[model samples]
Target chain A: MIQRKKSLQCRHVDAGSCNACEQELTALLSKELDIQHYGIDIVASPRHADALLVTGPVTDTMQPALKKVWEAVPKPRQLIAVGDCAAGCGVFQKAYASHGGVDKVLEKPDQTILGCPPDPEKILDTLRELMNS
Target chain B: MSEASRVENPYNEWINDNISHKKAGDVWLALTGYRDGQIKSHWLRANGRIDEVKTACMDAQFASLTPSLPEVAWDEREIHDLFGYHPKGHPDLRPLVRTPRWPASFYPMQKQSDDHIEWTDVEPDNPAKVVEGEGITIMKVGPTHAGIIESGHFVFSIIGENILHLDAHLFQNHRGVEKALESLSVQEAKPLISRICGADTVSHQYNFLSAVEQLAGRKVPEMIEWQRIILLESERILSHLNDLAQIPAGVGFTVAHQRGLAMKEMWQKGLSAIFGHRFLFDAMYQEKLAVSKKEQLQQLLASFITQWHKWRKLADRQQGFHDRMRGVGVVKRDDAEQLGAVGVALRAAGVSVDVRTLMPLYRHNRIHIPQVTGGDVEARFQVRLQEVEHSIALIRNALEHLQGNQQDTSWSIPDDLTGEAVSYSESPHGLNAHVMQIQNGVILRYHVKSGAYRNWPVLAFAVAGNAVADFPLINKSFELCYSCADR
Candidate 1:
């Protein structure tokens, strides 16, 4: 059965990223790839969000903050990891302050997009897939 | 202890004299030591650009340089934070990167302390201080903001719509990157360094590789040097486009913002199709396959250039846009210099200090540097536009050279190299520097002083007296990185 999907109201959490993921994510809202036109938009608050778009290796200092953001989102919300750093710590694996990745602090992510910073097209495609499923 | 007496600390005395003579930019502190004895500190003084170094040993404590040079305060605090070196006379000795969450006595980078031990959270000290005045209100924003950007906290002391003062507290994104590199080899540490600031990866990687190459007395092929320049210029174009979009967005000019965004998307798409990563992060790590789509990339850029010119012309003619940006968030020339502003902030303030032009390394040393004296948001925006034009010319020149010849792509670093070296590159944001002390090819201590680190304080200066609503326009004009600053 196809999932009854319409629009996704996403809230992005930067657990401990290097700002690369933020740049590409910002590009998704640009004119060329208007993810909003595809019924996908990044909302301001977690309460209004249907999914959480997370980035970074979940630094120790940010772990609690990340969890709080997760709790703020309503039930049945999806968690999508957006970069190599979010999936498995990437280059900051052994960092003293980092808690490895998003999964280390939270449960397993529903979707993972991999790259140093995954391209906006790939991000858009993944979001489209997530919405359909 | 008199100025004339060359007593116990001769190096400190010389630094005092040189700073008194009004040559602050030329004065630098070089602290060197290997896992032993009192660290040898040197005052690297430059007289009319002629460099000289004088060494001195610490006697348990030293007079801080920040008393004379206000710009040196942050570096002094960083020194205190990292090596546990106390700066006796410096003001605001509060920890910068190491927040109050750690145990009171622990210094992560100091020798003999095992930094890998589990950290326990302590109550964080109030990040913002209360400003008492008639009708004064204080507001705190972020570590998590409404926008899709990195984390930073801004404390604004306001009266009605005007901002009386602003303080920025960063380091929310700090992940001990420098500490993480300590146990890794030079080859192993390259990946971590490149990601220091995602937009400026090419420049950061270049600085690290160049530092290692210098330490090992090795040289990259001339063609490879030219290739590095092309990549740097390409990255600059993409980053400038992002900054350019913010100016229009700040003023509610959606058409101009969208137009700039479209060009930026095309530029990234061209790079991705040719190089395989939109931001070209992969290209920095390995050799590219070949320039199979040279014509296609060229056509894409050519169209982008045409579109950019059209949009810029339209935006420039808009009276409302000019009125909004013309005099907003002005950083005077003196304030920019005193606060150690770099890149767009410095250049827009009419200060001619660029790392590429100052220390020429690339094949194309004749790159045009833009300067606008207004020191406002419009000045910064103008600087970005002119720089885009210059980068386009640079990329074309490098591409023309690339079409003529192909070079072998194989390189390696030897296992054992022991030396301390510093290298810098002109990143899109500003000068990105990497100083590494290597002991037997493994990093002993690695310090990254990014452009964001120097420029974050300057933003606080720019926002003062401006209306609260104009803060975003002013802040976006600088376009600094929180992670780079925090690291």
Candidate 2:
């Protein structure tokens, strides 16, 4: 018998904005909205995760923590920008505090889902898309 | 005062003796208690507020309370900010959501006043204390977190996996919702309050309408009552379903999270079919929104509820789902109280305090909801599942009860001033209280206390002892909304 390994893992960095995305992103694994079927786990330790799911407009104040998490995650890891705020700062982009957008820093993202709070299914599908690629 | 006899107004003789409007200086209104699911009753001081309290007489100070009067006393500073009347020895005089530089000469509530352009810099609240020298590093999460949830920051000190101390850095830029709506008419202001917390819009609207009904001394039609209950239940089911899916994602149980999404979407779709949006904001009440066919809409809602129950049954039986959520993060009863947690978090900790039961309101008194206690992350998870099930039962009962009741959705302000009123309802997070003051057909003052003010801090405490890996797990157990606190 052969065991199949997960395609990728994620360490979430809450750069700025409220915790809605953090809750929704992590909640992807509950019995109600299972993300494991898609082979993704939101690891607390950056070193252990294969992907970095960065949710934020990445405010100036949180830049150090954001970059530190990115540095901590080992090489060859991809980035998944989940939520409209992360993708393009969403509703909060207009605010003075924001660091523009996630793309402004991360440069390239493996995926992006657009919604003030993106739907859970959209998140699962993004991981599935990663697994296939 | 005989046992079975109608008691006459004992104040009749008192009112006749000294009922004259004279020498009333400025009416000072201070909403003392905002969050704890209790209304912040304004002092309603006619001349000197202190003199009125001494002369007019009021009853009740606190009830099974967390002594949160100290914690939430910040609102008093706010009352002072906009009204210029001090809380007579308010303990903390620091800035709370407003500028210290706000002109002392002008108060926002003083009819016409200079608008202060901004807020004073928020002083970082002192983190919860922990004994020094234990290799416990203090790690602080934000008023901001990743993704779309509301804002709040948690500072955690941990000795290895054991949490040493937890304090939440709260009230990060929550626009003053309740305070701004004080001047709106009853019909004009329902939607504004409803949008206070996006997730709990239904409950907020319902709470206001119920309070309005109480204040107006008007009888709400049976149909409206039942319809409101249906909307409330729809809101509850969708919210709990949302919570159910959330638990697994926190700790990396993707399968359960996915299952939760489908289940939640199913519930949301049923709601969207009945009311336009899946979140069920406008559906909760007919607040000035024109409804052409009330009977047809009711029929549509009736059919949707039947389908929702069936869909939920299939979703609950997903395989390997429960494994991810059996006993993840646990908050003891003592800890839950100290941290001032509420809703499913408190129930999971075995406190058994639901606003509907602890403080019965509307049709909640008609239905009986059994208290559930598991006292862990899984317990919190189970509580929500149970609540969804309970919501189903309550919805069914409300629909049946609405058969011959009349519902008057049309609302108007009272022609004569009827004083002020306070209202409360439990939002998804915990207890939500609205302190409202009205005079001359306008909401003179509005102050809100959303439950998240207490829950997030307690959630920080609950996470102690759990592995850092489980921070999100413990977090979702409480699911404290920073936005609610910020607001």
Best by the TM-score measure:
1
Error of 1 at A89 (Å): 3.5
Best by lDDT: 1
Residue pairs in clash, model 1: none
lDDT of 1 at B373: 95
Candidate 2, residue B201: lDDT: 70
Per-residue lDDT value at B164 in model 1: 90
How does chain A of candidate 2 score by TM-score against the true chain A? Answer: 0.87
Can you tell me the CAPRI class of model 2? Answer: incorrect
Say what the RMSD of model 1 is: 3.1
- Reported per model, the fraction of native interface contacts reproduced equals 0.61, 0.12
lDDT of 1 by residue, A36-126 (tens): 9998999999998888988888876666667888999997889999999999858886676677888888989999999889888899999
